[model samples]
Target chain A: MSEARKDDTILDVKNLQTVFFTNSGLFRAVDDVSFNVRRGETLAIVGESGCGKSVTALSVMRLVPDPPGRVVGGTVTLEGTDLLSLDEAEMRKIRGNRMSMIFQEPMTSLNPVMRIGDQITEVLRLHQEMTSREAWAKAVEMLRLVRIPEPDRRAQEYPHQLSGGMRQRAMIAMALACRPALLIADEPTTALDVTIQAQILALIVDLQKTLGTGLILITHDLGVVAQTAQRVIVMYAGKKVEEAAVEDLFENPKHPYTRGLMASMPAVISFGAKTDARLNEIPGMVPSLTNLPPGCAFAPRCSLAIDRCRAEYPPLQEVDGDHFAACWRAAELVGAP
Target chain B: MTDQRPLLEVTDLVKHYAVRGGVLRRRVGTVHAVDGVSFSVAKGETLGLVGESGCGKSTVARSVLRLVEPSSGAIKLNGTDITGLSKAEMRPHRRSMQIVFQDPFASLNPRMTAGDIVGEPLGVHGLATGRAQQERVAELFGQVGLRADQMKNYPHQFSGGQRQRICIARALALGPSLIVCDEPVSALDVSIQAQVINLLIDLQRKNDFSYLFIAHDLAVVAHISHRVAVMYLGRIVEIADKTELFANPRHPYTQALLASVPVADPKAKKLAPMIDGDVPSPINPPSGCAFHTRCRYVMDRCKVERPTLVKAGGQHEVACWLNDGTGRAENS
Candidate 1:
């Protein structure tokens, strides 16, 4: 609590480096990642498949697997305590109690054999030390809070008995059973229907606000990021390419990759196409982690790449107040054509 | 949306798969997968079919390609009826129409190299042999943005986006007049998805082939499609031009579907969901209008009467009772 003001920081991560040791070489899944989440703030990590956004979140929770994936260097400080320094037993005590995670696939996350009621109550019993009757009652209450119709009846049903949306809501209820100080939702509604996705997203935002909980939403969908996150970190090839306030990021993107991403998205709301060919696709492929290009990893694909960019890696630096971008030509990219 | 010289016209397409149960394994009832769907794809035009998961949009695509035998309908390719043609009789007509499936990896044979995968169509149809097939395959590979040297590489050697490019080259082997794309880019990442979409658009412009693009993502569909069809529970609820459909969606379901899509601009005010409740079972669908169960403006009449696709404004059509009485307003 003395490390930083309680009002300023709820979770702070510094120099996070997650790597995978393969036969080919050492692959840095999350390279020197750093960020912080203020209390009750929603921070979204935006990236494509291999961008290490998920790895960063996993690194925060200390959930990185050992052999292949190891959080070699990082300080995931939560409420003045470094999660990385904590032992397995100490971390487990705080895992679902103070910090919880909701995975992308709800079907795979929840136990098929356990009833929805028991799942939620299991978290309550473990974290809060509630009695069987008290936990069961609270479990039903949480289900009702998530707006699951007939919560009492749904409590008895197994995971298979519920719809995709219902199963996800159950997972949310279980995650929020203890009112965790922080919630990590990795593509929470990607697998659900669009209609149901809206409902779930709205529910999560509302609940997080009501509980005053910090949230880290990991997703590839920019639309969802725009709608949900106050601030966003755009990751590319295991490195932070750009970070800015959501509004600033969308309105005037700094990095070429960020701009390309914004342009590539098909008109979500077709308000008379402004550009001839709306989608400006980023050419070439996302470079392999093992054999990344020399200097800037994105140099091979970057349209604005220069000789200097190809010779040395670009460090993520502040272009303006609270807006950071890792590109050699970040200054020149402002007011880009 | 019907233009001159329609390349593909599907009329009253219906496909009902049998559902069997009990000890005897007798036919209990029918799934009613695709019930009375109709659409036309003009020459060099793209017709996007969009709907929820179990909405039978894929069934319509499959039915049109004769991949699944329709219970009743007429499939006209270049104004020639190929509906009742037997396998041997329809063999040559297959050149006029082709299909590209969803999964890029699954669609391509793992054992076959990229060259073999794209060149197999030419060999199967006996259109070319040896050196000629090799030349055509190399040409297609280059056209789809893949290197000619990469042809020897197997499907597993390439990434998802490259594999999809190979699949597109395969679909283009015979220069088919119509290509049915069933969620081709759904599986790839957002960045890679754009490349594949751009490739498709470029190929369409150069080669000029009509497309029956089926997908659930309205944004992607609206980008490539000339006309868009919104399906719900085995029947299309609304059909209109891409801009018209996205601009002024008449049906409540269409409105909801469009609203459900989260806009990329965070500054915009959040759109509250118009309706709630999951899609009812297709096995035992609701009586009368299929969407009536979820429609916010549901009426007593909607429960008893099945609404048909009535002409609304311009080329737009809606199948809801709200648009029934005053729906038939001809613009011309």
Candidate 2:
């Protein structure tokens, strides 16, 4: 079973550590993170802001700036090719062709001056060997594929003319224009309203299934993760504290932080189903990466922390089946609600 | 609980923005940001105004405080109409209300210390002076779960969650009866959001203050609100008890809003959008029902005749033709 899983894996990240040389000190943004994405599977990296989920996405795309930010360690292999080993030109080819990315804010991510048609077609013209006319036709098809209404007319319109949802559809059109093997969407629907977000997420899932493409959805919303992803990796203070199948992660969270996050979120519970009004708020804030604790990063806020938990960092270990958690007391918290 | 008077009452609230064009900057069109919306918040109760972006929830909050002058409306605070009051005359009314904005970083004065940020409101309202003000600020800090020693720290020195606590402390300083929480916890992380939300709930319990909570998120709204008013294209589509609204939303828009919320239960099936298409542009809003274009149960009458808010029993009400006691809105 493991061998079959390994064979089908499209992207594999191992012990990845990324650091930013800030004025204060060196901030380890992505601290020894590792995950795998199989073909046609949706893997979600869920965490709060500044928890290094975005940095991990950037690292995989090889888009991190070198002067301040650097991938200090680890290997990111896409289709059996180590991305870190590739040169700038080779990596550039892989960036848009084999993999694509969509950002949080659709308004700013899209080109303001350029028409939606030209932007999508430009990708086709660059990577795929297509003429202007063919690229234009493909661009309209791409927009149509994303379920944009009046694709023919919308293609001629500028980004500002289209609505927020329309702009996001256009962005997805550009990203999926080449039918990339891997699509990394970092908070694609965060700026969108829930109604619009539902549409975009549905569009993404439908398109992903139809195209059989691997997806790495980076977001802070567990709801989005539950709706889209098959597997989830929960991050905290730049560390992967929990990794499990989406259902397992939600049903039996083995990490204290993961449990705390699920309890903290007010969205998951139904209206009036809550016996208690006050959410079980995690007592403290995320630890500063620049000045991390000597032991577990989440020890200060965790209710399950013991002397060993505070004295040493726990390594990621499998507690149940494929459900992995980086906590000393993972065994005690197994099958936890 | 003995006081029967509503803390805040808004009636026929309308706020429009002019769309200027070309070199002359002539008023070309009008964007009806908040078009004839009305609601009430009882003392010690939270009236959650939930909607999509640009749906005028924030505008309603701002208009209630007289921060943005309403084009037309009656805003009665504790039986006093302050909507037509002058800036100077509104000062006293302002003391009875305050707002905690969405972005704590942008809302706070970076130059001022946490102490000054909380104390400035006290000084401006003349509630406290010098030594008394300092003491009040420290007490407020303690109430919000911030350390007294950290009162002198700058906004930038604190974390995102800490900054929001400071903003909350500042809002609480005036001893306002009504506090408008404008997405107070949206900017914070899940764990931190809980902390802030719980803090707000505790503060409300202790002080018996009301909140005009405006947020796009339904789940967060349901957490605190006693009653909820769903908005779409600057109109109140439905208003009901939190339990009823969330469990049995009558309006198609409200139903869609509830269904669209992605519950973090992966065991559940993948859900589709209950409604389709985008909310029509507020600048050129639809003629009859502003939500008719995207509404699933759109009818011919829904296209021409605007549906007014109709009672469906109890505190439940909806502004949809489908809920006209008929099973569904069908011209046939």
Candidate 3:
């Protein structure tokens, strides 16, 4: 690879929009969202359920269902190639070869009938053009890379035979086996215990650094976003409310929604400061996407909402160097001492 | 306003399920779900039980409430041993102990209105009826941060957070002294989770009821609990005051559990996992210490000798050889 290409962005998404035509009406599950993933960078999309984080990921992968859901608009540029313009056959060649995804609940995602080793070997054989024996060896090596004990023996076991943690490790192995440039993990460790979560997270970070894979992690846990992500995008009602470096987001959140999330989460380590006071709560629930409030979607629930906020949606603007927030009162937050 | 007497005391609780297999349905093996667990919740105190899935924390909660009859144990409520009481005899005892489950959507009856669901307990206990029951139900709803007008709504009509509030209202209708909350807030979203936690804390302060709060989130437990008990496999490995336990965990499992929690700070450096591998199955748990399979400081003695919960210092108690001062000298 050329020096310039080595440092180039792996995934560039612009004006991404996905909608679901439910029985009630059409709702924008992913409103015009745009973000870029640099080479070997980890970009986290954090939001509660119904915030369209998962839809954004599916739109990027071009895996959105068409009958009820579709990526109505977007320019998903992968390594200078517009993935949105590719045909089904062409997209298939690029999917497992250039980008792959890890889903939550490995039991549902992984083939229960197939052996773990055979499942991974299938991906390698299909995308990498490897022979049966070579693929089998590589599958075992990938399992070993994920730190699975007795990789050779475990490869022959079915998904049910492994524990929950092991099943997730197998999923990670399968996702990274092809060494795709972009890896999208949706709530990868939400089902596992904290200890198991720690192990899996450490393995993913270590492997991503070694393989230089651009990771797009979608999760609701702020703690996870703080620990792993280099950059984060905070979504609310299917729109990007805030985007900033991980440190800046935690230290100085501009959007009221982002600030609410940070305030609500009970930090495990408070550096000796006592938090006996009542936890700050975001007053109303997330509005239904189909019946979102006029103008700003978050205006109803936001404490900093002004008359202008209810009259029109606030355009996402730069609050600081590279820190963007879509809030009418973001200037007030920045002006705070 | 705290009392010396414990609101609920559980001693030597053991709940085992016999796994039946083969054509004749013979007992193939025994799953020691809750093996010799013991704890006490003082009056007006909240005891948080923290553990991973399949760690028998749920079993402990159910046993305390007599929802599942323990295979063997003594469960005393306000100095009265209700463990051996029959269903008819346990009716009044049930009024003193209620439970709030994790999934409010599944726990609540969809057909019933929120008011009826909350009032059912009042009707069941024969405590109130007619206008009195309606008033009590409305008051319960208000206490949990729900509107009285919404009492006519069904469980499906409410949001996830609202459903949990209904569950809390139902749990509070009986005016129980001890409420066993099993992951009551885990199902709610992060923003809504804080609302429920704050409500629970405020309710505890006003009502002065003891709580057996079972959860996997250490931070939530640390915030709400007066004392915390860490369970691994089927045993309580450590129990201590919230601050003491969080600041200085004595057991290796407790320490690892704390270190495993991802700090909400990007600048915080990542540390290596203290232990590895998944939690072993409860049916065929390791011999000696249940956590020995994942302990970073494992020793040969830990493989053969089981450690019992012993006083380490102050109010803290740990069931590890490293701190118990028995098997460590020989191994060292």
Number of the top TM-score candidate: 2
Q: Is candidate 1 or candidate 2 better by DockQ?
A: 2
Model 3: residues >4 Å from true position, as ranges?
A1-7, A270-276, A335-337, B1-3, B323-332
Q: What is the fnat value (0 to 1) for candidate 1?
A: 0.56
State residue B28's C-alpha deviation in candidate 3, in Å.
1.7
Please report, in order, the local distance difference test score of every candidate based on alpha carbons.
0.88, 0.89, 0.89
Clashes of 1: 0
Overall local distance difference test of candidate 3? 0.89
Q: In candidate 2, which residue ranges exceed 4 Å CA deviation?
A: A268-276, B1-3, B323-332
| Per-model TM values vs. the true structure | 0.96, 0.97, 0.97
lDDT of 3 by residue, A109-213 (tens): 999999999999999988987899999999999999999999999999999999988999999899889889999999999998999888988888889999999
Writing each residue's lDDT as its tens digit, candidate 1 over A195-249 gives 8888899999999999989999999898899889998999999999999989888
Q: Which ten residues in a row have the lowest lDDT in candidate 1 chain A?
A: A269-278
Lowest-scoring 10 consecutive residues by lDDT in candidate 1 chain B?
A: B323-332
- C-alpha DockQ of every model: 0.60, 0.70, 0.67
Sort order, DockQ high to low: 2, 3, 1
